[model samples]
Target: MVTLVYLSVIILAWFATAANADIQVVCANKSVSITWEISADLVPYAARLFLGSCMPSHLNLLPSGKGEVQFNYGFENCKFKKQIKGKQMSYQNEITFRPYPKSKPAAFVYPIKCVYRSPANLNNQFLNPGSVSEGRGSLVFHMALLNEQLTGLATTNVIPLGSFMPIWAQVEQKSHQPLLLLMEECVAAHTPQLHSGSWVYPIINNKGCLLESKQGNSIFLPRYHSSALILYLQSFRLGHEGEVYIHCKLTAWDPDVLDESNKVCHYVKETERWSLLDDPFQSSICNCCDSTCKSRSKRQAEQESRGLRHNFVLGPLIVVEPDSPAK
Candidate 1:
């Protein structure tokens, strides 16, 4: 890597002259490299080549769920880099530039992005306290402990045989007793055609007495897990007013150091169903589009041919529930 960088320096120092040729490209995984590619005649001046690196543009993920991203390989200002050795001229036959920042760690920051919120958007199908039956659909929840000492990790709580499962699997096994559920809805004022900007976080709506569960406790008695959650959001919108869509977006990272090779690390498991902390398309996000960051015409057609991706899309995954719970 040092050799390529040094060689790039030589190319920039003595030989290359800034010409009319358009020059630029957006390399993946941060880091933009800009170098002037000169014809064979400028080889001697290429010895003076110097490289200038731009400060990387940093992007953060939104929400607090855990995730991991590894920077594989990337380079900026690639089209103009010259690779040669001892006057051994390689070809316009093909150009191969060295990939950089091989295996290095980044800071302890999470890859979180901010979700944009707009007051004018809402989902028409949603309802509230003033609406019809179903009691306006309230949510009551608690983290219950069956036999606090009878851990899901242990055998006494099971049927003698054992396999693999999460520490919270017991909560799922005994779906009765003290139950936990979270409810949320989105609303818009005049959500015309629901143009990708209609969504909201899961709001709280508790009813009756709430249930509570904690670790290292006894199972016979349940705690009064308390919350004053209700759906009196006058600003909330209805779901069915326009088109409704749910897309996924995750931002995860820890305090661990990231190396160049550290592409994915310390991912926060999608263990619990985390409520939405932010909506995906409240503002413009770079979902997909051909970028004009390059000067070459070859890449132009590639950017223009984007399909529906030109419009913002929630990440490709989401959990779906029915209008009413199972009858």
Candidate 2:
């Protein structure tokens, strides 16, 4: 009886400690914040953040703002493996947007393209082998949220932190392939040159089939176009050696817009929940300009030198603390 009681106590303690595992919250500005623990009892999705604990809670929330719109994203490093003996596996790729699209009782949706890979799982379609997708990959979906699924970008606030999502994937046999997905804020720039798995599309038809909105909101069209990326992983076997560029194109829509600045990276603190960083497309502050394009019409006038496309005037390399615990 004493042994049973001790075991129970130990189990309870283990559970308590497991909650709120350590996580590094990074902002685009290259700032680092630490999230030591999370709890399902108090916070629900705490367990899902840890790659070590592969429970059913498969969601990574990226908070946007309070409006309805079709968020296109994919994960970069999502892996799967059979436990000991091989077991059937299914997974979910979900996104938890912030402010919950505070609109009507409509449907909200986020799509995922599951590229199933086996020892021979070379296809980008469903993992079940026999499953058939349109082209290179199989696209699945998670929970449908509000009525914002079909609409274009609308009037919204900055997506708060704590938002998350999941990608649902399954396989007949047991094999684990880390996943890589991202959400494209726009769809127009998705081209062969755009190395990212997702895209940011221009005004198009009902691919996402966005919903219609009312007058209270602005025209809802974003001038500085933006897309979201759902990075399901940190790394993958690209079968090659190159950079995986995660680029976002901003469309400054206003005709009178002047300050077309760019932000390389920034820090996101735990306290600043809805932190906003600058866009990364502008020239790096580290590099300098030259007179190379002296005569080009679109080039910067000699008087206002914005040298080398990657002018080395950049700030010091961002230093981040190691995420893992004591080895």
Candidate 3:
């Protein structure tokens, strides 16, 4: 009776130690890889792989020995390839992994480019906003700043004092991998005495304004698509009698960074900054207008005499003027 009881206990323990299937999906560069591992004891008699809604035989599982089995599939052989063959596909896709009756199906989402066009121009969308369009290689970027009246928006080189300005960005990507877009007010306020403290950092409305993410976290440009972001801005003082600059950059996401929350974007060569009060667009900002506006050619000479200078790179410059009193 004791021997029979011990044998029953051993049989239950062996069954509990049975093997299972594990799967992982990784997307990098312009490719997506699906990898899976199955323990020897749990090798399936038959297996099937489905990319999106299409189950191509090219990725069908093959017979394996009773040890460990592994398989990998590339994006070209997967759903994207089916897309090239004139098959109807959805913008959002999923990869399904299943092995006979022993395991449950595991699915991973895939992002596909649905529409590839420039977002509607914010200047045309907003009232009295300034607009400027810039490009590098195949990629293009644009920015628009709120005009003095606050009813419209456009791109401008000068930022006034004591005024509220709203800025918007537009980007078009021609790359295979997703691109990261970063817009920053690159003024260093801590710089000593040359009026560096006059400029205010932009407040981004990642929720309603930017189409990137609802959580205000990731700002990615989908492959072969264009996107836009709205920048929250306020200028308490003019950083200088000269121009302020706003910088825009695009890069590929880095996976090696341990902190997933940190926005780790590697800079590409196409980075550009929008200039304020730059050549052809010049203005003197003050709460009470005193000094006459100088041309771009003469402003440098005047700045030297005024003894006001900045040692940091000027980004998108906002010329702020005093607000009208409550009527």
* Top lDDT hit: 3
RMSD of each: 24.2, 23.4, 18.4
lDDT of 2 by residue, 3-26 (tens): 557544544654565434333332
Q: Write the per-residue lDDT of candidate 3 for residues 37-112, one digit (tens) a residue.
A: 4334333322444554334323333366433223233332233421111122213245443332325544222333
Candidate 3 error regions (>4 Å): 1-130, 147-152, 155-162, 174-180, 188-226, 238-243, 247-327
Residue 150 shift from truth in candidate 1, angstroms: 45
Look at candidate 1 and tell me the lDDT of residue 242. Answer: 26
Give the Å shift of residue 101 in candidate 1: 3.4
Q: Kindly state the number of residue pairs that clash in model 1.
A: 53
**C-alpha TM-scores of all predictions:** 0.16, 0.15, 0.29
Error of 3 at 126 (Å): 8.8
Runs off by more than 4 Å, candidate 1: 1-7, 10-99, 103-120, 123-125, 128-327
